[model samples]
Target: MRWINILLGLAVAGILGFYGIRELLADPVYFLELFLGGLVRGSIYALIALGYTMVYGIIQLINFAHGEIYMIGAMTALIVASVLGLWGWHSAVIAILAVVFAVVYSCAYGFTVEKIAYKPLRTAPRLSALISAIGMSLFLQNYVMLAQTPEFQPFESLIPDFAFWEPYAHIITSVELAIIITTVVVMILLGMLIKFTKIGKAMRATAQDKIMSSLVGINVNNVISTTFVVGSATAAIGGVLIACHVGQINFFIGFLAGLKAFIAAVLGGIGSVPGAVLGSLVLGISESFFTGYFWSEYEDVFAFTILVIILIFRPSGILGKHETQKV
Candidate 1:
């Protein structure tokens, strides 16, 4: 299976490269635009994927409601920003506060979701937990729709409108620059948290062996909550950035983005942070290039196709290592 997956991956790469080269030859200028779009979009996917991957890593359960958390984040940001506008206080500083509010709200929602929906099922069948996650997802989506209106809300970009390297090409926009920079900074901080901090050590220990970590006094529940908090916070940031870039968002946005991020998590190896990021980049870049140069109608189809190809070849996923269980 591994060999087959490797071969298929190579084949896909070759086919994509063939067409990509042709497209580049046809229009180098437009290709650059597609590349930039992919990079920014991929960062958003990576942010959401971190939440899906992290929860799975610690609890061995997929928190399907995570996408709704992303949605809630964006909703929170929009509400806050719009309210502040009513007070005649619209500025970059206010925008930053809106993001902070979103992050805090997301953290609370993440914790509450875990405690109410997942805590009781800690020792139950994994399937039960999975079902609960799906239920929570539906509930949140409707709850938000009723509370915040189902109509699409436009997000204001805090960064002033500007362009760089205009003469050379339509290189990068201000919002895209903000997103890429924010993602890079957040990823670096996440890496450091996982590596240097005491809580990071506890979380790693918990992920490795929950029973042993508990025996050694690691307060496993706290670590799990912390994981959700961090994951939710990042997803919140992703939500705000995505809203700003796209300029509009609806309640249903989370479902699609969540599915893509879930695929990315699986594609890159669900339990590995770096793998999640890598998968997101690959999916994002591939999707952009396909829609840009080929056919926009099949953009969503492209990610699923890659998912099927990857699953058929390697059930463990691109960066996932096979594990054996003993009875």
Candidate 2:
């Protein structure tokens, strides 16, 4: 099965490369631009993907309101940056602070959501829990819309100019650099924490069997809450990055971003960290290519198509393991 997956991956890469070469033959610079755009977009997807993977790992339940959680992050960051920038703070510093605050607030929000909407259902039927999740998602969305005007607002001030000198040309954009650096750094720190720390082991054990973990003296509730906090914080960072990249925000911003991130998590393997990153990059790059080479209208279709294909071929996902039920 592993060999089959590897062969399939190689085959897919070959097909993409062949098409890319053909496209390059027609217009080389365009291809390069598309490639770069894909990488940037992929980083954003990876950030959001982390949130989904982390929460799913510990709870085995999908927090449908996660996207709304992300929206809160972006909305909060936008408000902070706008107010602070008006007060004469450096735009870069304001943006950074906004991101930090957004993450912290989002983490708190995640904890609250778990406590209010999920904790009670921990011992309930799976179907009931799922319905509750959907309800929570809708409630959060409408709550945001009611609290703030639903109209889209420009987030231009949050993005600062960044530049780098390259041998070929000078490429600069603080927004782009910020997204890449933030995502990479966060992923590295997360990877290290999960791989080397005691808390990470607790998380893994809890994921494998919450009851067993509790029996072994782990605080199951604490671990689960921590997982939600970590996931929400990462999603908040993703929201800020997306808002900066798009230069605008609306109450509905989280819907699509959350959907894509969820798809990325499934693609990578829901319980696998590296899988989420890979899935996110694939989704991001696919969307970029669709928008760049084909039509923007097809971007969503392209993303969903990839998800469907992955599901058909690898039902457990690229890096997911099959679980056995205890009789």
- Best candidate according to TM-score: 1
Q: In model 1, how large is the Cα lDDT of residue 164?
A: 50
Q: Name the lDDT value of residue 198 in candidate 1.
A: 97
Clashing pairs in 1: none
C-alpha lDDT of candidate 2 relative to the true structure:
0.84
lDDT of 2 by residue, 138-187 (tens): 88888988998789989864665533423333243566767888889999
Q: Compose the digit string of candidate 1's lDDT tens values, residues 143-236.
A: 9999878888777775667545345434778788889899999999999999999999998999999999999999999999999999999999
Models 1 onward score TM values of 0.95, 0.92
Off by over 4 Å in 2: 1-14, 163-172, 325-327
For each candidate in turn, give its C-alpha RMSD to the true structure in angstroms: 1.7, 2.5
Residue 229 of model 1: what lDDT?
Answer: 95
